[model samples]
Target: MTDTLLNEICALETALQQSQVRNDRIRLDGLLHESFEEIGRSGRHYCKATVLQDLSHALKAWHSAASRRMRRESAAAHSPQD
Candidate 1:
């Protein structure tokens, strides 16, 4: 990956970590969506098949993580664990 793309991904990862630390689901979800879209746009701009594939994988990973987080929170809220 290019330095710029790596930096962008790092920044997004940092933001995601911070959001999780703050328990800000709304902001976290928003950032996840934004990052996914940004990666998609980047792939389109780069016009590299490998980059596009990587971006798709990253997007799917982020989406899965976000979904898992949401489910965990919901379960905790409804369970006696909270």
Candidate 2:
């Protein structure tokens, strides 16, 4: 691929990651084509709607977990050491 195409592909990848992290459904939809379909490890099939719905839940869970982790780290950082 040419440099321009390669750069575009890389940028798309970054956008996809950001969309997932931010749970931006609009951006995610724009990133994927209508023909997109995901195959699960158990042979289940997922369409765009299913994926987006699941992504929102997953993102929320991740944020909660990350917040907990940060709070724990903060506590440890301020704790006294022997």
Candidate models: Cα lDDT each? 0.62, 0.83
Residue 79 lDDT in candidate 1 = 90
Q: What is the TM-score of each candidate against the true structure?
A: 0.41, 0.57
Tell me which residue pairs clash in candidate 1: none
Writing each residue's lDDT as its tens digit, candidate 1 over 1-82 gives 9999999989878876562532544454455543344345445542234434555676688889999999999988899752
- Clashing residue pair totals per candidate (backbone < 3 A): 0, 0
lDDT string for model 2 (26-53, tens) is 7787777788797989999988888778
Which candidate has the top score in TM-score?
Answer: 2
Please give the distance, in angstroms, between residue 47's alpha carbon in candidate 1 and its true position after superposition: 6.6
Please give the RMSD of candidate 2 to the true structure. Answer: 5.2
